[model samples]
Target: MIPSGHPDAPKLSPLKQLHWSKVPAANTRKTVWDVSEESIKLDFNKQILDRLFCSKTNMSRTGTHSTLRNQDKITIVDMRRSNNIGVLLSKYKLTGPWVVDIINSMSDEHLNKELVTALIKCAPTSDEEQLLQSYTGSKNILSPVDQFLVEMLKVPKIRERLNCIQYKQSFDSLFEEIINGSRLVERCCQWLLKAANLKQLLHLILNIGNYMNSGTARGNATGYRLNCLLTLSNTKSLDQSITLLNYVAKIVSDRYPHLLITSDPLLEAASRIHWKELSNHLVSLQQGMMTVQKEVERQQSTVGMDTFTTKMNQFIKSRLDHLRDAANIIRGVEQLYDTVMKYYVEDYSSPEEFFSLLHNFMTMFKQAHLDNLRDMENDKAIRPKIVHKAERIMCQRSLSTTSLPRVSLNLAPQQEENQDTVRSSAAAAAAAVGSNSGSSIQTKSKGLIKNFKNIFLRKR
Candidate 1:
C-alpha cells in the first residue's frame, strides 16, 4: 500500500487515458472548404478569449443567447480538431506553474472534480466487454487535455503544488497533534517513574490485594499485569455489598489523602493520547518529510544554495532531527515504564496499555472516594432522626407490656356479661320456635354467637 503524504507521484486513473475515436455519420453532405491551421488556432484562441469576457449583452447582440438558453436548439458545431493541447500551450507560452496557478485560483468545490471532467469526455463502458470493444476500435486517442495534465506532472514544482492542494491541511494537523502528544506522553511517563507519592500508593494497593488473595494459589505472585487494576472495583467481600476499590479509597483518605490526585496528570495524558492516530500521524510525517527532502534535493541540484530552498532545507532538517529524538525518548519511556511496573510486581508491554490501566484505576478511585465522603455526610445528617425513631419504638413496646395484664383483667367481667346476653337470646329464639324446629333454631343461635365473638375479638 502507498504511504500517506509520500513524495512519489500518483498514477493517473484509466478514465484520464481513454482513447476517443471519430464515428462517421451516414447522412452528412460533402462540402469543399479551405480551413488553414492558422485560422483554426485563431478561432480556438478567440473562443477562449470571448468566453472569458462574454456577457449577456454580447450574446444577445450575436443572436446566440436564445441558442444558449434553449435546450432543443441545434447550432453549427466547431469542426476543427487536434490530437493535443500543445499548440495552444505553445501559443500562450503557458508553463506548468501557470497551469497550477489557474487551477488553484478556481474554487475548491469545482477544482477537485468538475475541472477534470470539463477538460475531457470520459468513454462510456458499463462492462468489460464494452471496454474491450472500445479498445479494439481506437488506438489513436483524442485526449489533448489528459496530455496537458501529464506534461504538467513531469514538473516537480507543479506536482508538489498539486499534492499540497490535495493533502496539506490534513497532514499538517495530524503532524501537529503527534508532536504535542509525544511531549505529553513523555512527561507523564517521567512523572510516573519519579513521583514518590505514586510509588507509595502502588505499594498500598499491592499490600491490600495480597491480603485479599491470601488463601488463593495466586496470592504470592511476584508480579501482576497492569490490566488487573481495572478489576479493583469488581473485587467484592463475601457479602458483595462493597468493592475492594472502595475500601482502598477509605484507607487512602484516612492515611494518605495526597495520593488521591497523583494520577490526575497521568489520567489526562492517557485520555488525550490517541494511539492509532499518533501512529498514523508518525507514518504520514515520515512520508511528508521524504517529500520535502526530494524537493530540496531537486532545488539543490538546479539552483545551488538559493535563499528560499536553503531555508526550507534547514527547517526540514531541524524538525526531522527533533522528531527522531522524540522517537528515541518514547522508546526510553516505554522501557522505564516496564521497569517500574516490574518493580511493583506488575508487567505492561505498551505505553497505551500501561496508561489505560492507570487511567481506569484513577477514575474508579476518584468516584469511590467521592461516594464514600457523600455517604459519611448523609449519615451525619440523618443520625439524630434514626435515634429518635428507635426511641419511639422502644417506648411503645414498654407501654404495651406494662398495661397488657390490667387490660386483660378489665375485659374479664365484660366477657361474662357477653356470655349471659348470648344465653338469653338463645332462649328467646328457642321459645319462638316450635318443639319440632327447636334443633334448627339452636344451630342458628350458635352461628350468631360465633359471629359476635369474632367481631368483639377484632375490635379488641
Candidate 2:
C-alpha cells in the first residue's frame, strides 16, 4: 500500500481506518491525520509572527503612537459589535459610487430630509474622529462602511454643513406653520365681517329676544352679548315641550330657509388655533435666526467655513425679509381679531375663545333646528288623525239623535208603503245632518289645530 504521506494517497475513510491494523507491518506508513495536524500548527505560528511584525511596523511608522483612548476603543468596539454603520448604509441604499460622489461634492442636496436627519443622529464623536484621523492601516482591513466614514471625515467642516441643513429644515417647518395659521385667522376674520347670512340670523335672534322680553327691563335692547346665544336652549315654554331656540329655528326655517350661517370650515379650523401657541412659535423662530447669525459671524474667520457662512448669510437675508413679512401678517391677524370682537361686542381674551364660543352656539342651533323640523313633522302627521276623529264623533252623535220612521207590519199594505216612504225621507234627512256636522267638525278641527300650534309658540 502507498504511504499515507505520498502525494497521490487517497483520503482515509472510516472503513479504511478500521482495517488499518489488519495491513502488513512492512507496508505501514504514517496516516494523513498526523501530517495535517502538524501543518495546521505551523500555519497558526506563521500568522501570529506576521501580525506581530505588522504591529511593530505600524508603531515605528507613527514614532511612539499613543495608545487608543478608552473612549475611542469603546467606540470602535461598539461599531464592531452593532455594525450600525452597515445598517445606515443599507437603509439609505448608499452604494460605494454614490457615497464617493457625496464625499467629493460635500453637498447634502442629494440627500433627502429623512436621511439627513438620520445622519445627524448618528454623527461621529470627537473620539471616533481622532481614531479615524490617526488610522494608518490599509483600507482593505476596514469594513466598507468604515472606509466611507473615513473618507467623509476628510472633508473640512462637515458638521457645520449638517448643522446648516438642520437649521434650514427647522426654519421651513416653523415658518410654514406660522404662515398657515395666519392665513386661517385671516379667513375667519373675513368670514365674520362679510357673511351676510350670519348678520341676518343674529338680527333675527335679537328681534325675537326683544319681542319676548317686551314688558321687562331687557325690552328694547339694541343688542345682546354673543354669549347670550348660549342661553337660548335654557329658555323654555311653560310646558317645557319647546325651547326658545327651537322657536327661533322654526322662524328661520319659515322666513329665511336659505340661511346656513354656521357651516364655514375656515371658522372651525380657526377655532382650534391658540394665539399664545402661535406667538411662542414666532419667538422661537426669531431666536433661532439670531443663533444662526451668531454662528455665521463666529465662523467668518474659519478657513474652510466659507461655504457654510456664505450660504447662511444669504439664507439670513432672504429669511429675514420673510420673517418681517410673517410678523406683519401676525399683527394683521391680531388686529382683525380685535376688530371683529369689538364689532360683535364680545369680551373674549383670545381668538380661540371667541371662535370656540361661536362653534358651541352653532352646534346648539343646528340641533335645535333638527328638533323643530321633527316636531313639525309629528304635528303634521297627527293633524289628519285629529280631524278624522272629530268627523267620526260628529257622525255618531248625529245618527244617535236622528229617529227612524216607525214600521207598522200589522197595518195594511198602503200603511206599510207609507212607512217605507217615511223611512226614505228620514234617511235623507239624517244623511244631510251627517254631512253638515262633518263640515262643521272639519272647521272646528282646523281651528283646534291652529290653537295647538300657537300654544307651542306662545310666550309664558
Candidate 3:
C-alpha cells in the first residue's frame, strides 16, 4: 500500500540526504527542477575488479583489487565531470573511522567549507576533476577523492542516482541497513510461501513486483529484485524454481504486467537483454495474430512496405495499435527477462533434486534473516482480494482462449431432384464464378487483385 505522508519521519543523514534529496529549485517563470544528477556507473570494470580483488592468487585484503596495509584506507568518490565514479586511495584504505580521522577535528562549518571549496575547484558537474586525477601534480590537493574512478554517465543511471538521493533518507549504516533489509525481506517472503495461504503469498509477490515497476521504487528495488531472482534461480535444482517461475510468471503475466523492469536497474541495462529467449512468450499469441491476418488477407488481399515489421508485430500482438503497444512493453521488459534467465536459470536432469535444493535454500534463507515478520502467514490472510483474482487468472489465462472469426457458408439442399438440373445449375454458377475462359478469368482475377491494393501490399 502507498503510504500517507509520515509527519514524524526521521531525518536523513548527510550522505543519504545528499544522494537522495529531490530539492525543488524555483524557476524564474517556467517550472524547473534544480536537481543535479551525479552518479557512478559500473560495468565490465567490476568484473576486472572482482578478478583482481577476489582472485585466489590475489594479495589484496579480502577480494579488493588494491592491496593496502590495514592502516591504509581508500575513498569512493564521484569526481568525473561526466557523472562517473572515482576512486582514490591513501596507501591503506579509508573507512568511516578514517574519514572521521581526516576531518573530525575541524568544526562542521569548517569541514563543509573545505569540502565545498574542493568541489568547486576540482570540476563542474559537467567538467572533469583535475586535482586528484592528474598524474604529475604536487602529490595531492588538501581534499578527499574516491578510491576508484570510472567515466561514463548513462542518462538513465543519472536519473536513477538523482531519484535515489531524493527518496532515500540516510541511515546510520546504509550498507548494513541494505544488507539487513534485503536478507530479512527475502527470508520473510520464503516463510510466507509455505506458511501463509496461497493467496497471501501471491499478494506479497505482486506487491513486490509492483514496487519494482513503480518510479519511487527504482532506488531500493534493485535489492529486492536481486533477492527474488536469486531465490528463484535454484528452481531447476529444486523443481521449486520452475514451479515458482511458472507461478511468478503467471502472476506477472496475468496481473502485474510491469514486473520485468521499471524498478529493476540491472534489467534496464542494454547488454543484458536477450531477444531470442523472449521469443517464446510471443509464440502462442502470434498464432492467433496469424489467424487474424490470414482471414483479413483472404478477404481483402493486399500488402504493404512494412510487411516484415507488420508480420513481426503481429507475431506478438494482433491489432496494429496494440502491436505498437505490445512492442513497447516487450522492448522495456526484454532486458530484465534476459538478465534473470542469464543469471538464474540452471539445468537439471530430475525434478526431485531440484526441489531438494529449494528446501535447502529456504532453510538458508531462514537462518540469514535479520528481521522477523510476525505471523507472516496470518498477515497474509489479510492480503487484498486481488491476489486471489490473480491466482485464478494464472489457471485460466485470458490470452490462452481467443475468439476466432466465424466463417459462414450457404448450402443449397442436395435434394433427390433431377440430377441433370443440379449439374446444370452448378455448371452455370461455376461459369459465373469463372469456370471456363481460363485466361480471361485469370485476366479478370488480375484486375480484381490489382484493385485489392492493400491485400496485395500488406501481406498479413
Candidate 4:
C-alpha cells in the first residue's frame, strides 16, 4: 500500500487513502491524518525563512480589501517586527526560484494558499523602487511564477477579472484558473466594464466588431455596439451605461447613424463618481430639453395664431357686406347716380334705357352676393357704436330736486318779519317744529318697538 508520504503521491492506495478524485468533489479534501482534528497546525516561525515567493500578487485597488489579519486555526500570523524579517531574509541563501514549482505544480491547497499570502506580506510596501531592483535574488531572470504575478497586477484584463471575483473563497484553486481564463473570454464584457472611459471601451468594441464576429474576422461594425448604446442609455449604472458609446467615433465613422447623439454624459461617468453631481447634470439636461420644447410650442402657437388671423383678414377683404345703414344710404344714392348716368345722362332716347341699366346693375350686384355682403358690413360697422351708446346711457344718471330749498334766505325772511312778535311767536314756531320732530322720532321708535315686541311676543 502507498503511504501518505510516499513518492507516488499522485495515485494513492484506494483502501487506506481514499483516492480523492474517486470521491465527490465536496468531500475530496477530508484527509486521514495521523493525529486528532486539532493536530494539523501552522508554523509562522518558518515564515521569515520561507519568504513564500510563490503566492505574492498585486494588491488590488479596484476591489474591497482588508489588511491581512492573523486569524485562529485557519491561518495564523503574529505581528512580527520588520527588523526581525529583514534580519531573517539577510541570512538566507535562496539558491533557486522560491515560488516557481509551488505555483506551477503544487496541489496542496492549505500550504500553497498560506505560502502565497506570506509572499504578499513580504512585498515591499514602503520602498518599492529599491525592492523591485533586487529581482528576488534572481541574477539571470525572474521565474515564470514570480514574473507572471508581478505582471498580472498591471493587466487591465486580470485586474478586472479579479475585481469581479468572489471576495472570500477558502481555497484558491480556481484563482489561477480565473486569472488565466480572463484571456480566453470571448466577449469584451470585462473590458467594457473595466475600461477607464467609454470612448476607450467603445474603441475596443469597434475593433471587435471589425475583427471578431462569431470568431471570424469580418471588417465592419456590429449592431451589438449600437444595441449596447441604446441599452446603456437607460442605465444609471456607469459600468452598464457606457458599454455602447465608447466607440461612437468608429461606429459612425464618416457617416453618423444619428445626427443627434442624445446620450447623457453623466450616465456614462465612473461608478465611483458623485451621484449628486450626476443628478444635477441630468436635471440641467432635462431643463434644456424642456426649454427647447417650450420654444417650439410657442413658435408653433404664434404661427398658427398668425395664420388664422391672415385667413380671417383675407376672408373679410373678399366681401363688401359690412356697410352700416347710415353709410348704405349714401352708397345707395351714389349707386342710383351711376345707374342713371350709365344711360340717361349720356344719350338715352327714353327712360327705358335708364331703367335697363339700373336693372342690369341690380342683377349683377345680386349675383355678386352684395345683399349678404351689405348686411355683414352693416352689422360690423354698427356693433361698436351700439355698444358705445348703450354704455353711455347706462353711465348717465338724473337726480330729482329735494322739496326743501338749498338756500334758507326765503325761510329766514319769513321768520324775521314775525320776529317783532318776539318770544311768543318764536315759542309757537319752535313748539310746532318740536311737535313734528318729536312725532317723527316717536313713530320710528314705536315701529322699532313694535318689531321687537312682535318677535319676542311670538317667541314667548
Candidate 5:
C-alpha cells in the first residue's frame, strides 16, 4: 500500500491504480484520449490523475472544498445543500414553488406516500433550524429550493403539520377497522347467548358433574361457574389414562351428536380478540382527533393557512359524527356482554378472559374426542387375539376335564385375586371423580356474589 500523504508518489492511490490495471489496455487508452479531447474543447484541467484521486471526503478534511464546506464546520445541512437537494427535487418531479403550493393547499392528491415520507425524513433538526434562522445573507445567493426550505422552516410546527397530514390521509380506513372490531365483539356476544348447541353442551357438562359427585356434599348442585370448565382436563382417572373431559366428549358423541358440530363461525375470531389492545386503539383514536383539532385551531389563527384550516374543519366535523356512532356501538356491546355474564352467572374481568376460557375448553374437548376414537380402534384390533386365547383354554379344559379338576381348583384363587384388583381399580376411579368434583364446586361457591357484582358494576 502507498502512504496516504506521500508527496513524491503519483497523485493516484495504489488501490485506484490496481483497479485501472485490470481494465483492458485498449479501453484505458480510449478513455484517456476522450478526456484529452474534452479538455481541449472546454478548457478543463489537464491534471487527470489529480482529478481522479480527488473525492468529497478528502477535499472536506483537507479544506480543499472550503467554499462548499464552510471552513471546517461540515454538517448534514451542508451536505444536503451541496449535493442532494437538486437531485431529490428533480427525481420527484418537484419544484420549490410547487412544493410550497402543495404544503399551503394541503392537497393530499398531489402529496403521495413516498413524497410525504421523504419530506418527513428531510425535516430540519434543531441545530439546522438555528443555523438557517441566523443566516442574514442575501436570499438571491441561495438556490430557489434552498430559499424555499429556509422560508418553510420559519413556519411554527411545520413537522407537526406534515405528520398531521399523513394521519389524516389514513384516518378513515383505520377508523373503519376499529369499527369492524367492535362489531365483531357484538357478534361474539350474540352467538354466546343465542347458540342452542352451546347451551346444551354446558347442560351436559353439568349433568356429568352431578353424576360423578353423587352421595357427596356437591352431588345436588344445580349450577356451576363457567371457570370450572377449564378443570375438566385436570381431573384424570386413577391410572391417568382418561380425563373427565374424555368422558364428557365420549358421552356427547354417543348421545347428543349435534353438540359436536360447531356452526358458529365467530368462535375462532372471538378467541383471538385481545380486549386491552382494542381498548387502547379506541383511546388512541380519541387522542389523535384532539391533536388534529389543536392543529386546526392553530392554522385558523395564522395568515396564509386558510385553505388547510378549512379542509381540516370539514374533516373534523365528519370524523366527530363517525366517532359518536362508534361510541354508541361500543356502549351497546358492553351492555350485551353484561347481559351474557348475568345469564351465565359467571364472573370475568374482560370479554377476552371469558371467550378464552370457552375456547380452551372446546379445544381440549376435541382433542379428547380424537383420543377416545383412537383407543376404540386399538381395542378393536386386539379383540380377536383375546377371543382366540379364551377359546383354546376352554377346549383344553373340556378335553382333560378329569385331570384338570385340580388345575381348576388352583385357578379359582387367581380368578378371585383378579376380581379384587378390578374392584380396587373401580374404587380408585370413583375417588378421583369425587375429589375433582368437590374441589370444582368449592371453588365455584366461594366469593360468588361479590365478584359478580364487581364485574357487573364495572361493565356498567
Candidate 6:
C-alpha cells in the first residue's frame, strides 16, 4: 500500500478495486511467505556495491574503476529507454514501497552522461528541459518525471513488486477454475461413453428410421441426424391416432427398460454445461497456468526471492499440474463427441447444442410413452361395449332370416280363401239391390233364374 501523501500514488481502476476486494487476505493461511521489503533498497544497494567491488578486484589487471563506472552508467541508460519496463510501471502502479526503494537506491556512480542525455529527451524541448531542471535543484538537473521513470525501470525491484503483490491469489483462483472445469468435462465424457441407454435409444431410432424409408433412396442410411429425434412425435400411425414414436416408447418402457437408465447419469450434464463453453474454459485455464509458470520463472532468477519461488513451484506441482492430464481427457472426449455427431449426420459439433438436443429427445420420448399407455387404457375400456353391440346385431339378422320362409308358406293359402269369401258376399249384396229396383230388374233376374234351372236339370 502507498503512503497517504505520496505524490506518485497510483489510482486504482474500479474493476481492479473490485478484483482486490475478493482477494484472500495477505496474512491468511498460505505456504508462500510474503517477504518484508521494509528496507529492501538499503539491503540491495549493499549487495550491488559488494558485487561491484568483487568484480573490480577480479578484473584489476584488465580494467580500472572507470570501466566499472561506465558499465553501471550503461545499465541505468538501458533502464530509462526500455518500453516494456515503462508499461509494467503504468499497469501495476508505481507509488508503493517498491517504487520508493528503487528511486532511493540509485547513486552518482550509476548516474552518468547517458542518464543526463535520456533525461533531456523526457521533456518536449530544450526550453522545457531547462525549465524543469530548476525543480530538481541545479546540482541535480534531472526533472522529477524523468527521475521517476528512471527509477521505475529497475528490473529487480519491478520483479519483486510483481511477485509480492497478487501472484498467489491470481494463481489460486485460475488453478481452481481450471481443475473444476476439467473435472466436469471429464465426468460428462464418462457419462456419454458409458451410457447404455443412450446407445440403445440411438440404435432403436436408427432401425425405425431405416424401416420408415424402406424401398426409398434413404432406406440404407447407416445412421440418422440427432435432430431427427425431435421429429419422432410427428410420425403418424396408419390410423392417424398415434405417432410412431409412441410405439417405440411403449416398446422401450416394456421391453428395454435398462436402456433408458443411461440417461439418468447424463441428466446433470445436459442441464449444467455446453461443450463449447467447457472447452473455452479449459483453454483459458491452460493460458493462465502458462502465465503463472512464467511468473514463477521470473521470480526464481531474481535474488532474495527464493522462499516465494520455492512455495509457488511446490503449489503448481502438487495442485495445478494434474489438470494437464484432465485436459488431455477433455480433448479425447471432444473427438469422440464429434465422431458420434458425424455418424448421425448431425451438425452438432459442440457440447452445448448436443446436450440440448438430447434433452428435447428425452422429453418427447417419455411423453410419447405416456400417451401410448393412455391410448391402451382407452382401448381396453371400450372393447367390451363394442363386442356386446356386435353380438346384438348378429342375433337380429338371424331372427329376420329364419322368419321369412315361415311367413311365405303358412300365410299364403289362408290369404286366397279369405279373398274368395269376400267376392261371394259382394255378389249377394248385388242381387238384393236388383230385387228392390222394380219390374225391369225383376224380369232380368227371372231370366237369370230360368237359365240356372235349365243348367241344373241338364247336370242331373
Q: Which residue pairs in candidate 1 collide?
A: 223-345, 224-345
What would the per-residue lDDT of candidate 5 be over residues 310-422, giving only the tens digit for each residue?
78788888888877787787778888989989988987857878888787778878888889999999999999999888755643333333221111213345354444343
Over the full model, what C-alpha lDDT does candidate 3 score relative to the true structure?
0.35
Output the TM-score of candidate 3. Answer: 0.15
Please write out the lDDT profile of model 3 over residues 1-460, one tens digit for every residue.
3232232332111111123645445542343443334313322443344334431332456633343222222233442532221221333343333334333232233334334233223222432233325434222221234322212121112222222221111211332333333333233323323443323433555565566467764433422322344364344425432344444544543565443222112112222323333333344344545554554344233333232224333433424444444445555443433343343343432222333343444343333221122334555776756676764553233123233233222223543233334334333333433443556654543443333333323332
Compose the digit string of candidate 2's lDDT tens values, residues 233-336.
99999998889988888888888887755556788889999888998899888888888787677767665455556777888998998788889999999999
The TM-scores, one per candidate, come to 0.50, 0.60, 0.15, 0.13, 0.62, 0.42
Q: State each model's C-alpha RMSD to the native.
A: 18.6, 16.3, 38.1, 39.8, 21.8, 26.4
Error of 1 at 177 (Å): 2.5
lDDT of 5 at 60: 62
Best by TM-score: 5
Q: How many clashes show up per model?
A: 2, 0, 46, 11, 0, 3
Better of 4 and 6 by TM-score: 6
The alpha-carbon deviation from the true structure for residue 88 of candidate 5, after best TM-score superposition, in angstroms, is 10
In model 3, which regions exceed 4 Å deviation?
Answer: 1-281, 300-318, 337-364, 367-460
**Which number leads on lDDT?**
2
Which should have the higher TM-score, number 2 or number 5?
Answer: 5
Runs with alpha carbons beyond 4 Å of true place in candidate 4? 1-84, 87-96, 125-131, 134-460
State the displacement of the C-alpha of residue 173, model 2, in Å, after optimal TM-score superposition: 5.7
lDDT of 4 by residue, 242-308 (tens): 3233333334433443421222222222222332332344344334334434443454455443332
Worst 10 residues of 3 by lDDT: 9-18
Q: State, as a TM-score between 0 and 1, how close model 2 is to the true structure.
A: 0.60
